[model samples]
Target: MRKQPPTYSPQMTRMAFAASFAFAITAPAHAQSTVTLYGIIDEGVNYTSNVQTSAGHGHNLYSISSGILSGSRWGLRGVEDLGGGMKAVFVLENGFDVTNGKLGQGSLEFGRQAYVGLSTPFGAVMMGRQYDPVVDYVHPLMPSALFSGSIGAHPADLDNLNNANRINNSVKYRSANYGGFSGEGLYSFGGTPGSVGTNQIWSVGFGYSSGPLNLGAGYLVARNPNVSFFGTAVGATAASNNFGSSPVINGYASAQSQRIFGAGATYAIGRATLGAIYSNTQFRHLSGAISPLNPAGVEGTATFNSIEADFQYQFTPALSLGVAYNYTAGNNANDAKYHQGSIGADYAVSKRTDFYLIGVLQHASGIDSTGHAARAALNGLTPSASNQQAAVRIAIRHKF
Candidate 1:
């Protein structure tokens, strides 16, 4: 899940898929250069309870899904040494579904990442489509990422702990590690003519590591979040729909501005690791007609706060187990509350392959972002027909 712009970023890996192949060559004057190829394949069988339908009702669902634990993808990475502790680097990552063999990330080629920049002892600065600072820093420390994956995310991945969105026309900076401390800052241009405030996003994040302790924090703000952060589609509400219809964030789709802040810490003790994370998401100046996002057409600011605690234990060299609990509370649109839990077990067959089993359960209460009764909604899936939802998955992931 971590893409190294300069191949110097910190990563908290726990059975995480990371493998690559490099080809080296001699450039003019013997300037060493290298190009790498990397990819991953993930497929799974899933069964979910109480999936909601258009009639305001629901049904159970069973299907084969791709990229459960991690999105299936491939990419090319190149680096050329320029002498004196400096180098030039570039990456082109593509996301796709193993099942349908279709592009992911809104069907954009190289949608996952496309950037190039110079790397020095200080850091690397790249411009292109890229992930925000939160995804670079704090997300790796979240339970949804380090262990159980997407299903473990707070309701609807409201705080973007699941990388539901990426920034376009962006320049990002990743700092060199100093005394176990590193950081990132990102800025995205709106690219909208005549309106600088229409679609702009900026973020900053930092992390610290010492011994077995890891800590991370990040803050992000987006203007015209619907078009800037969600997706810049043609209609007024079309862009916001890119984030999906989950009540947790739907109503705030038309928010004139959005802000997200998160922090977390993880520590390892013996054969076990434990972590906790907290996030705050706020949408200001909601606007739009009575749609799925704004069923009540309420005009006001909305806020959601979430926290999660997770634990993982290594039972053996090849097998590990994880569990996590998450809570989210919302106000303004409605006083909604979401409680979710996840259980996961993974067995490593080799350095590049693993099998996993995961179970997730969720319960929701109060009014939702849509102004209706809250419903259990897991990240990357349909909302539950009822207030409670349960799901199970068995999958395999291979990296090459």
Candidate 2:
């Protein structure tokens, strides 16, 4: 004998279809993509001794400053799962001055970073304005970035160790971590209709980290640095790339080509850590452009060599102290030497909040890029009329 399967009624069939639809909607909800908002707020007050005054003399200056330890910024980050072990990611960050509520990075929105990319098992490829290789790899091992912040950077930050600038119209590649080693590369387009190489920038870097040791090295090259970095600026007008009138390398802004190479290492032993860094920057085919540092027009090549050593001790789980020394020398258009020292202490109020105090002192000698007597200038502070300058800061930072 044969048996026949039972058939469902119309009402039962409709109910089965509805049940399946409900399950489908609920099943994927757990795996849905996510978006997150985050930000950091850093505020500080500073006092500098021997700031140059309008009367061409040294005077003390007191003011409120922002981003003493870390730049105040907010951003949005998002990720979407695409299945097949792949995902899409994007980030948009904005830098701002906390004191006067002004925009940082030349008053442009999303100035700090803006990029979108796909993350695969192999690596990631992104496109947008972004940090170059030096900043991504080598800068992390430098004391200026790890501990002392902007005040401890190499003279003028000529090596880009502090990430003073970001590349625009860039395509970047970051490799997947391979047994504590990783690498990155970046290329920025000039965006000129007739010229493919003009105003272009390229960089590459590698990093390794295992246990308590970290090492990094990188190289960067930029063509028509001034025209590319600062947008369109006519004769003698300072643009976005110009830090101000006081930095040591301000005169080299008109360089047709700029090159930078740097390497750094950090070792941690127990509660103490030691770090060292070396960098070389070269400005080639300089244009005879008028600038605050080169009123008489700079013609010829220039180079700067910088070295830094630093140490940090974690006295307690919540407290740490750091000290660093920097030496920099320049040649060609300007012959100058700078010696700087910095010390700082940070007390963790919580995992996301901290209070810090830092002090820096610097001295300069020889002839400046302007062909005048070299003046001492602490990073992010005014140049002193004499050859000695000092600054101190107290700040509070919070992250979310």
Candidate 3:
């Protein structure tokens, strides 16, 4: 080696050292670090028996829609094994429309999820934007997660039980399961200067699974629900008019706070599974919310109660059927009521590809937050101009 060194050029010696250094650095990292890209694409043709327009006109609608069964998204997951029963992990998920290549989730990049965390034998801690406990733990037991997808969600998805919305500036903790029992919680910062609790959100969830039975419960509290529960406002109008989408809770935007509590259970028997769920949503101390129902705007309280029942059967290894019914009623404020029903069939062509057909029907009664006659509204679709609305979708989904 010494004789070879004497003959070697400085450039060669430098190259050798650089190669060895790079190898040493990359070898261990290559073995411990990994990154994966995954995504789901769902699209279909839909027929809505009635679709309401801004003019309040109801008309038959035929359109191509995305996410009838599952939301279209692409995500990257990364993991680094830190050794000694520890690891580092992160995820960046983006929601988009396959038809027009437009960003989903209010057009924000990586809006579906963007978080980083550390994992240990005990549990995992994640920070950034993510789903709340209700959407995580209890939602899976809902009919929407099993079959009909968004359309199967309760009227307006008022309780956010079907992942209709997400939390921002959040820190979440997940505990490892112990004998089929586990739990999770999250706290979100307001991020407003000098106002500690102005836009904060907090959620907790507990779950249990044993054999063929599953149970879960969750609770969520939000300050400034006008911005936290509803989407962002359009400019200064946000101060007084922060409501957007469904007429279900639009009039209660001025509520001082928001609270939602829900619990659900599922029992599986061979090829069939039966599920039930209950939820209560409240807007406390509503103030200055201008709407047709509350023209003068009052400081009253509003609440919504929902109950759901569902059944699913795996007819075959690649084919499944599901049906669900949900009843939702509002207390006093708007006195709105809705009955929704859905049935769906799914067939798998391969492990990552599937086709599905789903039909949904909704009937509304009482009064709506818009101060007009109650209208039927389904999740991921526009409201109807009348009391009853129906829709059917044939969709294909692919995962990678």
RMSD of every candidate to native, in Å, equals 10.9, 6.9, 4.0
Quote the lDDT for 354 in model 2.
94
Where's the lowest-lDDT run of ten residues in candidate 3? 231-240
lDDT of each: 0.85, 0.85, 0.86
**RMSD in angstroms, candidate 1?**
10.9
- Score every model by TM-score: 0.90, 0.89, 0.90
| Predicted candidate 1 versus true structure: per-residue lDDT over 143-248, tens digit per residue | 7776677877888887887887888889999999999999999999888799876688999999999999999999999998777888732243543355576777
Per-residue lDDT tens digits for candidate 3, residues 151-178, read 8788878888988778888999999889
Tens digits of per-residue lDDT, candidate 2, 14-132, equal 99999999988676566767778999999988999988888998999999989867889999998888888798999999999999999887786888899999999999999997999
2 or 3, greater by lDDT: 3
Which stretches of candidate 3 lie above 4 Å from their native place? 1-31, 232-237, 240-242, 289-298
**Candidate 3 global CA lDDT score:** 0.86
Enumerate residue pairs that collide in model 2.
Answer: none
